[model samples]
Target chain A: MKIIVLVKYVPDIEAGYQFNSARRLDRGGDGLLNQLDEYPLEQARRLAEQFGAEVVALTLGPDEAEEAVRRALQMGADSGVHVCDAAVEGSDALATALILAAAIRRLGGADLILCGAGSADATTSLIPVQLAARLQIPALTGAASLTVQDGAVEIRRDLDAWSLQLAAPLPALVSVNDKTGEPAYPSAKAVMLARKKPVESLDLADIGVDPAAVGAGGAKVEVASITPAPARAGGQILDSESDDVVAAFVALLQANALI
Target chain B: MSDILTLLDDPAREAERLAFAGAIGRPVGVRLAGGPELAARPGTVAAALATLAVERDAAAVLLPQGLFGAEVAALLALRLGAAAITDVVAIDPDLTATKPIMAGTAFSRARVTGGLAIFTVQPGLEAPPLAEPAEVVELAPPAAAAGEDRVAVLGLTPRAASGGRPDLLSAEIIVSAGRGTGGDLGPVEQLADALGAAVGASRAAVDAGWVDPSLQVGQTGKTVSPRLYVAAGISGAIQHQAGMRGAGLIVAVNEDPEAPIFEIADLGIVGDLGEVLPAAAAAVRAL
Candidate 1:
């Protein structure tokens, strides 16, 4: 059995970001495998270990994207596939999903496909279901915990108000939440083993995707403009615990008819 | 401006979506998927929406933003060859969209390249205009697009819940605790009781297991716009700010003066929350 994990190298979300002429995130900036992607990677590794299944890590990016696949190998993937192409740059979630689904098809197929709830960069959370659509497979998204049994996967999907336990057959996709588990840190020995993990690089031509069909031209949504979020104005400070503080708070509440 | 169509399967959500339409000053029509009386699944309901969007010739369809909204919207857009955007905070008169990304660090104004825009509205939008009587349509979803075969909902189970969780979306007053609560929600709950407010937790507190995950307030948890919000011991991460930034009034209580939560807070109290919170709750009760 084999599982495919989707990995993305995104701008370091913890640091400030740089934008390009297209107003999209600059891929040239410093990046790492998206922090959210770690959840799905870790969960897929666990599933692979238990069932003795093979796990493949797939990513689409520029030259640095290879680092993302390398990270997965250190974490315990069997091999890696990098869908690197110049035209793949600046693709929206829709176009990106199309490229990824095509790559997955080129890999033959997958018993299970796993990804994060959303990427730290885009935060769109659109590709999981979109990839499932293009693959003609079922998708159980926002899964807090997932277990496979009898060729079907059951997931605890957490929502704002309630949680749903959903089940989908094999050849399905599930986007795991960050709560899946703490990622297994790569040991020095494991890091050494990752060097021989067979990292294959493919381009649009290799995957049979039309170069003209992606990138800026094929993106569904266009950024008309991007402006930094307005800085929050300084508000009144109440450091001293005077009688005035409590009275003021209650007064404001009453004024708003909140009390 | 486009004629608005809102989707409703749960009658309870109709008002919220209608309020969104009213907030944007648009005359609206409603597509009741599976009728007002029927309890509809997400898949069938999604198909119903797809059918209704074309039947009514809608310019834009407003969906009540929830966990399932974007997936359904995207699928429907793909089927109809339209456009979809989630977490649409506002729509201009010219029909441009303003949405936040990267946990609210940046806001992008976008316009769908294609026609027939589908948008998901956030909770607690402000200043609803007068709502006109809306026409309702019922749809029988196409057999192939119903998507029932793709995934099945086995059941719903509670996640180590302590009690009946508060509905933070509609709560008028919310008292949220952060990691600084020292892993105990007692003082926060006590303050919430004093103010008749809902109990909320930051992602830090939720991840720490000090409060119920359902009580989490953040980008990933829930977005709320209450009349009054009190943040106790939260660090004010960009993620948490995305949820409560819409509140009418924000008060922050933390030991650190440099906590980011104080930046947007209307009132800042820099001190020990353990002492300040109980004393303030006692004061509120006295008032």
Candidate 2:
């Protein structure tokens, strides 16, 4: 069996980020594999270790995104693929999915395709569905737990009001959340070995995508404006160390009818 | 310009959704009352909605914000060859949709450069309800086309609605904890119980395995807009603030004097949560 895990390289949000003049997130900064994608990557690695599935880590981003594939290799992926092209810089969810689906097809398809629930940078969570639409496959998203057997994949999804168990036939896509497990840290030997792993790089043309059909020119959504939200004013802060503090707090809640 | 089609999965939110859609264009509400089996098949649902949109010449589609909203919206967008937006908080007459970005520190106002607009509107906007009920037509999930990929519902476990605490998404009041809890949510749950509020946790607490991932309140978790939010032991990172900033009233308790949560909180107390949360819960109970 073969599994393809899609990964993304996102700016370290904790490192502080800024929007560029085009209202796009400035990707020029220290970056790392999106923490969310690690969950799916870990799942792929587990499948490779236990079921002898061939794990291929794939990414679509700038040159910096190659790091995501390298990290996946250290985590036990058998190979890596990075689709980097200048024309794909400003692609939105739809355009991104078009490119990724083409890349997956170029790689001869897979029995299973996995991705994180959402990218930390975009937070749209649209890619899994978009890719499924473009590729004509079943999409199972936000899976808390996942299992594969008998040419079918099943997952438990925790929604706001219900927990649903869903199943789909093989050649499907699944996006998992953080509940999967903590990703194993790469050992020094694994990290050194990852450098020797072959990573195939491709561009828009290589993926059979027209340059005019992607990037800013082909983006369906246009940013009109971006502004910082008005700062909320700090209200009264009381010293709970003082006597009658609990009473004072309770009175406030009572006044608001919140208690 | 054409009519905006609003997909109503929950009738209780009809007025707000219609009002929001009405601002963009003429509102044509389509009520979708699919059962669990149909709801599990987003592709079939999207196909049906796409057909409806075309038959009605819809310039845009509005869907309820929920678990199925984004996926169905994406599929519908793909079918219609339109642009899709989710978690929309505002829309201008010109159809510019505004949503939170960078974890709610900023807002991104965007418009479809071409074709149709598909959106999942966040609930609880300040828009006034329609004075009269709009016409709502029931929509049924169409049969899946031949050779189309479909998902099967193997099983389902409905969360107890009334007998348990309110779900985090719809809770009017929320009591959230953070790293300061020291991996203990006991006091947090107590306060939540006394106030009938849902319990939430910061990413730090959730990462530390102190709380369920469903109970996490942050950028990567669930966004909530409650009537009142009481945050305990949380320093209020930018991501955490994103989830609760829409709340009407916010109260924070932290030992640190300069915790960022106090910046946006309407009321704050500086003290150890170990002492403060239990005391607050006890006081509320006595009241």
Candidate 3:
């Protein structure tokens, strides 16, 4: 079996991020592999090891995106694919999905595709399903736990009240939540080995995607304007030197009739 | 032609979506997917929405916001060649939209300039009911997307959570635990049960493996806006606040007086949540 893990190089969410004139993220700042994407990468590696599947990490972004794929290779992926094009910048979720689906098709398909539930920066949680849509595949997203066996994939999805066990045949897409567990860090040897691994870069034309249909120019939606959120206005704060603070808190809830 | 076609998957958001339509004063046609049972696939939902939007000649389509809903809205927008925006907080009569982006650090006001637009409205936006009922159109779902049959549900079991966790999106009050819980959520769950509130957890607690990641309320987790958000042992980081700042009222209990959670909380109590949550739960039970 062969597996493709969708990874993204996102702006360092911990850093204070700012937007560019285009009202999109100013990726010029410090960037790193999206934290959530790590789960998919690690999980795919585990699955690959179990089934002796070839794991490929695919990333979409500008030049810096190759770093995401490199990290995946260090963590045990066999190869890497990066969809890097000037036209992909500022692309909405749909456009990103189109590009990825095109790239996936170009790769001749795979038995399974894994991705994080959502990105740490955009946090839109859109691309996973959209990619599945474009690929004409079934997507089991937000799966808390997943396993593969007998050409079938089973996932346990937490629906707040119930845990649902869903099974999907091979060649399906599954978006994994963080509960898939912590990602494995690469050893020095693994990191060095990743340097010699194969990395392929493709542009819009290479993937047969129309240049006019993506990027900021082709984006379907436009941000008319953006403004920074206001500073948090400090609410009433009371010290807890005594238990009276609890009484005050209770009283406040009472005053608001929330109690 | 109707002005808006809002997709509702959960009945809990019916009144809210209707009120939003009324607030915007736009004609709204509804496509309510089965509740609790989200359509097996987002592609099916997208197909249904595309058919509805085209059949009704709606200038815009609305979706109740969530992970899956936003994805379908985007796909439908692409399929229909329309504008699609997610995390929409408000839409004015003039068709202007308000949505948060960049992890809630920024707000954008946009108006779809094209012939058709799709917007995903955030939850908890409600107003008085419309004078007339919203238009409900029956939809025959299109054929499933290719390979959709590959995905099958094998079983469902009630997740054995101690609190019988309420649906966070619909819960009126949310009792959330943070790192201050020291990895134990018993008191938090007890407090939530006592208040009949859903139990939510900060990313710290979830990452620490103390709580399920699904219960995480943060920029990277589920966004929510409830009538009351009781944050226990939470330091009120910006990411955490990004998800819950819209709550009608916020109460924070933490040992540190300088915790950021207090800055946005309507009421603040500086103490151990292990003690405060239990006491507060007991008080609520008494009340």
- Give me the candidate number with maximum DockQ: 2
Give residue B264's error in model 3 in angstroms.
4.5
Q: Cα lDDT for residue B197, model 2? A: 89
TM-score of chain A of each: 0.89, 0.91, 0.90
Q: Regarding TM-score, does 1 or 3 come out ahead?
A: 1
In the range A109-208, model 2's lDDT, one tens digit per residue, is 9999999977666677777888977887888888889999899999998765578899989899998888877889989999999999999999888889
* Candidate 3 lDDT by residue in tens digits, A1-259: 9999998888875577778877777776788887778888888988978989999899888788888888889988999999888777878777888899999999998999999877766577777777886787788887778899998888887775567788888889999987778888899999999999999999889999998888888776677888876655667776666556656766766787776
Model 2 residue runs over 4 Å out of place are: A232-239, A242-244, A247-259, B145-149, B160-167, B178-186, B193-196, B203-214, B235-239, B255-268, B282-287
What would the per-residue lDDT of candidate 3 be over residues B8-103, giving only the tens digit for each residue? 566667767876776764656565435343545666678777876787677777786776677777677767767677788888777789887766
- Candidate 1: give the clashing pairs: none
Error at A204, model 1, angstroms: 1.2
In model 2, pairs of residues that clash are none
Q: What TM-score does prediction 1 earn?
A: 0.89
Candidate 3 chain A weakest lDDT stretch, 10 residues: A238-247
- TM-scores of the models, in the order given: 0.89, 0.91, 0.89
TM-score of 2: 0.91
| Candidates by lDDT, descending order | 2, 3, 1
Which candidate would rank higher by DockQ, 2 or 3? 2
- For each of the candidates, what fraction of the native contacts does it recover? 0.61, 0.72, 0.67
Model-by-model DockQ, in order: 0.53, 0.60, 0.51
